[model samples]
Target: LPAEKMAYLRSLQQKNKRVGMAGDGVNDAPALSQADVSFAMSTGTDVAIETADVTLLHGDISKISYCLSAAKITMNVIRQNLFWAFFYNIIAIPLAAGVFYPIWHISLNPMIAGIAMSLSSVTVVTNSLRLRMLIK
Candidate 1:
């Protein structure tokens, strides 16, 4: 297929949709460069490989699904960790600073606060580790 035709097709698709191009030839480089996500085979021309967003090291096209799935899972794990971290800080900081002492006479002991902070960090790490199980 002509490179110009490929470029024309990409232009039409890109106006309202994301385009993913997979190519292995130098002639495919331009379209690959323009694609939202481009995949190049490891055995392809150097220009195609360099122009693409991702290289399939073993030239197995099926791995693209795995890559996309893993990316989504990783993003979710990051959001979960951030939420836990922020939630811990929001509740923990004010108590440690004695903000509730006047209202309810509640104060966090410094040693206990330290332990709680450490535990919060551990929780985030453990939550991240859960991804290993999910991804496989």
Candidate 2:
């Protein structure tokens, strides 16, 4: 029965699902190994700790919520950064390529183009750093 359950739990990864298992017993080792993210208590058996990706120091479950929240925030920051970076590239590349030169006779200077490129990079980085201000 344990073996069947273990295989069922491990099969989640084959379906392209991100599975997280929290186990402390020796029998939990196999399923924990199969999971993408395994949480084991610091006070768990040695084998459990060895198989887990994350070890709960005080065996506290509340930390799991904090971990999930941090991961969500990180994903949010990544999306925000990607949007601004792509926006900058989409607008700047055409301008730099002299797309406006024929109709408006407006040519982008190489020096100013370099400065603008640098500024966009700085903007993206600064925006990403906003995560540092999030409440812990």
Candidate 3:
């Protein structure tokens, strides 16, 4: 069994950039340990549990899809946060530093800055919460 498993892993490694194995039995222990990421059922054998990197808390395999969706939403929120942070800093910093003062003496008020910062945080949190809607 180990020999066949190793052969399949080798073949998979050759054809895929990344491969993961999920199993819930003692017989699957070695293969689970050998894969890039192993997902073990909460009710799996001790050996399977010990060999896996991720253990499903409720033993529901469907949670894997939910997890992936949440991850995608989290990543998107992070990207949006970064974009907004960079955009605000690039524009606001220069303006607040008086870069435009020579022409119009314009600058962001401290109260406005505080409001904008709070709004940005709210936006990120709201975006992250959208993941709940994605779950089936």
Candidate 4:
């Protein structure tokens, strides 16, 4: 298709929809530039590859789904890690400070608190490592 038509199609699609363009021609550069997510074949024209958001190394369309899936998984892991870190600190900080000493006599020893803090960091790192298995 002509570059003009491609650009027009991109404009129409962008009004209320996300546009994803995949093309290997120099003519596709304009549309690719305007797309929300543009994918280009590594074997395609230089212009197309340079304009695209992602370049498929083997020029395989299936990799796009895999890329998107991995991105979602990575984002989930980040959120989980953030939640774990914050939750651990929230519960551990007060206990370490002896906030419950007046009524329930609950407190964390300094040495144990240090170990627990280290363990919480390990938990976050371990959770992030789970992504390798999931993506594979």
Ranking the candidates on TM-score from highest down gives 1, 4, 2, 3
lDDT of 4 by residue, 20-121 (tens): 778888988888888778899999999999999999997998898898888889999999999998999999999999998897999999999999999999
Alpha carbon lDDT of each predicted model: 0.89, 0.83, 0.78, 0.88
On residues 36-116, what C-alpha lDDT tens digit does candidate 1 reach at each position? Answer: 788999989999999999999889999989878887899999999999999999999999999999999999999999999
Report model 3's TM-score to 2 decimal places: 0.68
Alpha-carbon deviation at 60 in model 3, angstroms = 4.3
Models 1 onward score TM values of 0.79, 0.73, 0.68, 0.74
Top candidate (lDDT): 1
RMSD of 4: 3.0
Poorly placed runs, candidate 1 (over 4 Å): 1-16
The pairs that clash in candidate 3 are none
Per-residue accuracy of model 3 over 1-136 as CA lDDT, tens digit each: 8667756876788887466777888888888877877789999998999998888887889776666666677777779878887887788778767788888888878788778778877877777677667544
Best by TM-score: 1
* Model 2: per-residue Cα lDDT over 1-136, one tens digit each: 5586578876776787888888887888888888777889888899999998888887886687777777789889889989998898887788889998898888788889899999988988888788888628
What residue pairs clash in candidate 1, if any at all? none
Candidate 3 Cα errors over 4 Å, as ranges:
2-7, 14-16, 26-30, 57-63, 100-105
Model 1 misses residue 7 by how many Å?
A: 5.0
